[model samples]
Target: MLKEKGLFGNIGVQVVIAMCVGTLVGAMMGQSASMFAPLGSIFIHLIKMLVIPLVAVAIISGAAGLGSSQSAGKVGLSTLGFFGLTSAVAVALALFMGVVFQPGVGVDMTGVEGMFSNVYADKGEMPTFWATVLGMIPTNVFQSLNEANILQILVFCLFFGIAVSKLEKERRDPLINGVNAIVDAMVWMINVVMKVAPLGVFGLMADAVGTFGFSALMVVFKLFVVYVVAILIYGFIFYPAMIKAFSKTSPLKFLSAMKKPQAVALSTASSMATLPVTMEVCEEELGVKNSTASFVLPLGATINMSGNAIYYGLVAIFFAQMFNVELGMGAYIAIIVTSTLGAVGQAGVPGPSFLVVAVLLAAGIPIEGLPLLFALDRIFDMIRTALNITGDAACAVIVDNMINDGPQETPEPESSHHA
Candidate 1:
């Protein structure tokens, strides 16, 4: 199901080609390549169009069905706790590596001085972590839908789905069937939109490269290299180890099964845009039950950001090293806490990350040189989104495996997927 027949039909190959060509074109044309940004925007918008509805439908269907599980509450809590734990681990790793490697030491600040700004400082004070958690509840669900507040949508759908589950069997079955049919419809729409992924990826790469260029990277090439290594360590090492330790699934098999969704994540750079594909691969390819895939994947796509956690931790260390500021024990704790929670608070949408600002301030690091990283965030976003989806899949696989071992009245959470 993940494969395409001919060479040209392979969307993954096509996306890679587009990414390369777009980077080349951007380098050649410079800021003029900004014209292609609309192409990327259109694709993202198309994907966004389906995300809210797909999430709602899938969660409703999954939760309603999972309502039958004796340990359903345990399943949901475990998934949340797993993400938070992994993110915390990842940030701790990043901080350790940053301190050991010191990629930010002896940096030139000549050109970096001009790009620094305080405008983004206000972004840090927007919402405390508790406030963001509280805000997940929808005051008006219709308003939540209109605003596309995913967390609120998730909460509302769970309440609605559980209420439906409590209804008479005759009533519940019909509504579940209806919601699932809509799930299939949304999946089809995502498929249609994905055909143009190459065009959209090209635009995104061009705009990001054209505007940012590689000049800014020269000063921080060492940091970029270290950043990539940290990402690879988490993506390949930590995640695979988790799969090996916790699930019957092979690490190689789980990684190979992840290719299609990872490609989409790379091209689109939005975990929300890639959710449908993630759900599909999780259920069909990895043998994750439909219910586990639905609930865990959607929640993971929204909040699980181990990669971002790594980035935040490293960046905080990067700045501290660059300034020769000694980070005390308290600073390290602050970095870990802030980065882990900040990454968790991140929305799945692909955009320049402002959460890094909050991490820096919380740890008392200066935020002066952040614009350089902001320019490079698109590339970073692509990489991290892949990690996010991988985490989503890992959680689903492990959680599904755990549920299978538990006491259950109904073994199957739903009918066969893609039926």
Candidate 2:
């Protein structure tokens, strides 16, 4: 018989209750609830502290385990291809939804003028494509880590990991073991920090709702609806279809196994934090091989951001529509490409909403609209993080099927011995 889960045992239940209570408190107390903002801020900071090391070590360890450069290259290419394809499709779907729904219509923009002006005043020039690519190559690795530039850190880890894998066993074994130890340590830290997730989420929700109240929510309610609809379609429809089409896996079975990891993702709102759970579910529940799960899931955590792609596309178009900026064919295409690429480069950390800045700048949408979106970001972050992990697990199944020729078959039960 399965053991019953206690109140504290289910983090999802705790977080949901916290969100509801926080919203109620915020609605009741208004600005006074803003006092709780620091609680959430501290939680976010704790999560961010792990991002750089966790990403670097995860990637390094995963790459080092690929056994050969050729195998690494093949898996790397296939993994990136899957991420890129799914992200592009997600962005396209979001764009289609944005155009069909037109979520920004009939919206009030009265108090937002000050925010727009402030952000506009501080807006820097958008970087060129080549310059942006060049920026990924870090001049100083330490500086990149200090600044938490994920793309730069990713580039460094890729090179460092590949180089390490080339070393003879004598030299490589120690480095590999050391990196694995660090990855394990970081995961342990994640578990410890996640213990306070309920309180953290409570503070975040309270502050968000308290400060903005219902007005902000009403203004963007349509956009929120559109975003939720898109997420549902992608998570329920797109992912399952892909899994079945590629691997003949039962969609119901896959989603059933994903429950725990999805819960963790929804509460933490950070893919990096949810990585360990995702890996566990993929291997133990879904029966994905460890070698494939280890390599694909970590890389997917870094790059496979289907949910972010959708959000970026939707937000860029929403802002464009709100600003009455007419987008040409080229502009729409740019939105698709830029949003997909932006999601690719986005760090798997909390507060990924900031990465939408690049999407807006690329599409010539005003940066001032970001503050408006920021108000609703936390709720969306939960949804998107869940989708991100789902996509990761699904990709693992597909890749495993391709590389390993589906799951290994279990031997028939041995005849009972009748001594």
Winner by lDDT: 1
RMSD of 1: 1.6
- lDDT string for model 1 (1-419, tens) is 43586887888788989999999999999999999999999998888888888888988887887776676798889999999999999899899889889999988777667788777877885477679878989999999999988889989998888887778877778888898889888888888898899999999999988988888777788788888899889889889999999999999999998888888898888898898889888878899878778788888998899989988999999999987788999989988988888887787988888999989988888887788789898888898889989998999999888888777565534555561
Give the C-alpha lDDT of model 2: 0.80
Per residue, candidate 2 scores C-alpha lDDT tens digits across 134-191 of 9899999999999988788888887887788788878887787788778778877877
RMSD of 2: 5.4
Output the lDDT of residue 8, model 2: 54
Clashes of each: 0, 0
Weakest lDDT window of 10 consecutive positions for candidate 2? 410-419
Stretches of candidate 2 exceeding 4 Å from the true structure: 1-4, 110-115, 121-126, 406-419
Pairs that clash in candidate 1: none
